[model samples]
Target: MKQITKAVIPAAGLGTRFLPAIKACPKEMLPIVDKPTIQYIIEDSGIKDILIISGHNKRSIEDHFDRNPELELNLEEHGKADLLEQVKAIADINIHYIRQKEPKGLGHAILCAKSFVGDEPFAVLLGDDVVYNDENPCLKQLIDVYNTYGGSVLGCQTVPQEKVSSYGIVASEATAAERIFKVNDMVEKPAVDEAPSRLAVLGRYVITPEIFSILERTEPGRGGEIQLTDALKVLAKQQNMYAYDFIGRRYDVGDKQGYLEATVEYALRREDLKDNFLEYLKKVVK
Candidate 1:
């Protein structure tokens, strides 16, 4: 099993959903609570080097990770040592940024990191999806499965039948106690009748270098975009592919409701906000 040292994060999307707010700020920079969404993914993965593929208007995302000495000094001088340390730690992780010249799609954004990832197996984490797992870090779990199986691993979860068409559905055979399945087929946003299974691919992925070639050859699919799901389907034909039902609560922040839900859930988890927020929720519900 190769040590998956590098990870790719595609943050180049235009994020038209939260237009006004995203006009000046990248969606990936949106805060879950006190930390930006991308920071959560980075901290969760615990990987050393992360390649963030951004677009023209996303330079602020890169700058957010860079050292902010003046801000840190101000925080420290204000007797906010904890906040200062927290901000300073953003620079601790090794991060590299690459620009996606065009909004081709997820696959294209990933292609921008080819040189950074080289020929080694790397992890791809969608910046918009946040997985809240208490038992194990979602990415780390997928990496462990990749180490044991030495193949592509996708993070998946069981969704209701009505929602199958909204995700990349997988047809798989049970292979482990942890809900890890050997994937036989995958379908992207298939209609209810066409879906392979109820298990939908989530945001986490551990893919081999072979995907780069497949992605290059894959034609644009839905929405005139080079869908990563299309490339994965091709890769599955050549090599073994597996899906792990990652243990976590995933928040799809791309949608308005999901974003609000994530904010409330994350805020409620914080010690400072938990009790009061829960009490407020009780009052509001009553």
Candidate 2:
């Protein structure tokens, strides 16, 4: 099997929920504390050869990862050595981008990366969801499962019954190994009562190249856009697809409430900000 080295990040969403905040800025560029949310997704993926699938008004995502010589020089002139290193490190890795001409669905965004992905099994990390695990990054967990099983693996986490309608729900049969399931079926945004299971497919995916063919033939579903879930269902029928309940705390940073929670929780995790932030939070609550 090919080693999972390449990753595709779909950042083309219009982010209608963010409205004015995202009017001129890409939602993926929204900073959680100091780093862009997409940066967190990139780092979490543990893959340096990344191809970001971007769309209109998303040039900032590219600029964020590109070298800023003028800014670096200014930082040097100001004697901000530590800060300079951080800024430089952001552009130190190999990152590339391809624009998805239209605001197509996530499936189309991923389909744009076919040439970049070639024949290798690549991981897909959506900027909307950021999974945190210091010991094992979420994408790494999925890749490990893919390596072990020699097939596609989806990163899954259990969601509340009420929340099942918001995610692609999976029905699976348990494997002998813990937290791994042979996915039998998946329904995209099913009604609460009709959901097959609460095992929601999260943003992390380790998909084989065969999916590209499946996606190409998949007709647009739901909102008249090619749905990845639709293609995944077809893929599941043809191949051995497994879902692994990855160990991590997932934040749906795409949603307003989830975004705020991620920001606060992430701030608390920082050694330099935790004490002051926590004290401020305590004061505000009272």
Most accurate candidate by lDDT: 2
Per-residue alpha-carbon lDDT of candidate 2 for residues 160-279, written as tens digits (9 for 90 to 100): 999999999999999999999999899999999999999999898999999999989989898999999999999999999999999989999999999999999999999999999999
- TM-score between candidate 2 and the true structure: 0.98
lDDT of each: 0.90, 0.92
Model 2 scores worst on lDDT over the 10 consecutive residues at 101-110
lDDT of 1: 0.90
Best by TM-score: 2
TM-scores for every candidate against the unseen true structure: 0.96, 0.98
The all-Cα superposition gives candidate 1 an RMSD in Å to the true structure of 1.3
| RMSD in angstroms between candidate 2 and the native structure over all alpha carbons | 0.8
lDDT of 2 at 122: 93
Candidate 2 segments whose C-alpha is farther than 4 A from its true place: none
* lDDT against true structure, model 2: 0.92
- State in Å the error of residue 151, model 1: 0.2
